[model samples]
Target: MSSLTLGFIPLTDCAALVAAEAKGFFAGEGLDVTLSREASWATIRDKVTVGALDAAHMLAPMALAATAGAGGPVAPMIAPLALAVNGAGVTLSNRLSQALPAGAESLQEIAAGLAAFIGQRRAAGEPPLTFAVVFTYSMHNYALRYWLAEAGVDLDRDVRLVVTPPPRMVEQLRTGQVDGVCVGAPWNTVATRGGLGRVALRTSQFWPGGPDKVLGARAEFADDDRLAPLLRALVRAQAWCDVADNRDELAVLLAQPEYVGAAAEAIRPALGEELIFHREGACVPRLEHAQWFLTQMRRWKQVDGDLDAQALIASVYRPALALEALGTTGLGAPVLGNPAPLFDGTTFDAG
Candidate 1:
């Protein structure tokens, strides 16, 4: 059996990887896999880049960023499979949420209320509100920025953006260290239930079916002979995780201290409703998805210098490898639904 070490952060979206290891899917593929729980996305990125981890549950954009050297040193990486999607949310402290007008439920209402509130704070000469995200390359960061930008709030000026690991989000909010956060569940669920914050927006509300996390592997390992088995094992694990009957059990498994480490009740909702692991060919790494991340990276000026977008996306997002892995399982890639409209009614043209 081939021995491999994989890393994952404690988030509900890390389910597929946790399931693959707990359910013996990796062993079934004649592979010995050890799952390492890391503290932050940067650790996952650097470890995977330096070969400390054979693969990892990684932010989709982080994989692309690592390859393009956007936010850190360039170490080419590839996402052979997406682990889950639609599992992130933007949450605000109770102080902030309560400041909004009563019954301001929609994103428009929330953003309008927030903009007015920020203006009032500016007049009062109060410090800017601080919002936390898991990492610079994460969709959490991009999604939060996208929503705020549409509201005419300048992330760089009107607010302060900081990096906080998923597990620390709730505590930071509780202690008033940060006013809000954009992070994956069940941290959002944790905050809301603990009465620390209110979930203002689900990522799905804006980018329904958007890419989230993926099975990120270094370039050399992706080309190795073991890549096929690794992908197949993950595909099986993802399919198993998608079954409704398996959710409760999966939640319990994820709630262990070594995994997501939240209560099963907190983890269950995300597994059952908030996250998509394998439905609609969710595991396939779509080029458009990668292109969209690149578009955001450029929109935010994260990617530097002139580079070939198409070629970079082609090299990083490998749906063909997913296809090859699925072939053996007698499964066909399902057609994905049409892209969902953004909150502002804007359509994304990844040109």
Candidate 2:
């Protein structure tokens, strides 16, 4: 088998990659894979761009941002498949957490209380509260921005959003480095349970089924012969992950010292449903999903150049590759579009 290297962070969404290796799906596809565990999102991006690793479990928006010449030097990248969606939550400091009433239900109510907190902090001449996300061009950042923006919490003047690694989120919150965070599990669950912070809202409350991690590769590798075999292997791995019976084993696989490296019980809190590895028709990459990231970039001015989103989607998101790979196998019929509707009833025009 030919060997390839891949990069990933220790998060719940890296399951497909973990499954592919542990389940021998990659070997079945005639490939030998090495999964390098990196510490930060910047490490993933830099390694993938320079070909230090062949591919990575990457943030969808960061790939597009790289193409738009915003964060890094523009690199040709493509995401052949989405790994998972709705895998993150917002954690607030103990002080802020206490402001909300118990059993406070909806996102709207939470946002309203947050707005009041912001108003109070401003009135008292306190420094704007700071929050952290995984990366500058990440769904975590965008989701946090959208949730805050909906409540009239200005990203620029009212509060600051910084980047922090997943493992470090709880310490940052406890030390007052950041008052809140929007990070993927089981970090959020870990933070809340450890009493460092409280999970105020989940990314699902902002946009359910939103695209999360993806199989990101330099377009050179993804657009060539290697892409098909790779996608096929991952598709099979996703199927293995989606089986209800395999859920416990999946958690155990992800918790091994080589992968996510968290406790199995801690890992189980966000597995199965919270970090969805597969569904009836959700494996393929969607153009509208990319468009949502582009729209947020434009809305937040994260891009340096005027990006034609449709063209970017055409270039990077290859749903056809996922479809082609699925066809060759008995992996049921495919249905892989994410409509990505928001909870606030605000529709996204993915143009």
TM agreement with the true structure for every prediction: 0.97, 0.96
- The weakest ten consecutive residues by lDDT in model 1 span 342-351
Best by lDDT: 1
Pick by TM-score: which candidate is best? 1
Report the C-alpha lDDT of model 2 over 255-318, residue by residue, as the tens digit.
Answer: 8888888877778877766777768566777788788888888888776346677888788888
Q: On residues 117-224, what C-alpha lDDT tens digit does candidate 1 reach at each position?
A: 888898899989999999999889888888887888877778899998899999999999998999999999999999998999998887878888999999887778
RMSD of each: 1.3, 1.7
TM-score of 1: 0.97
lDDT of each: 0.88, 0.83
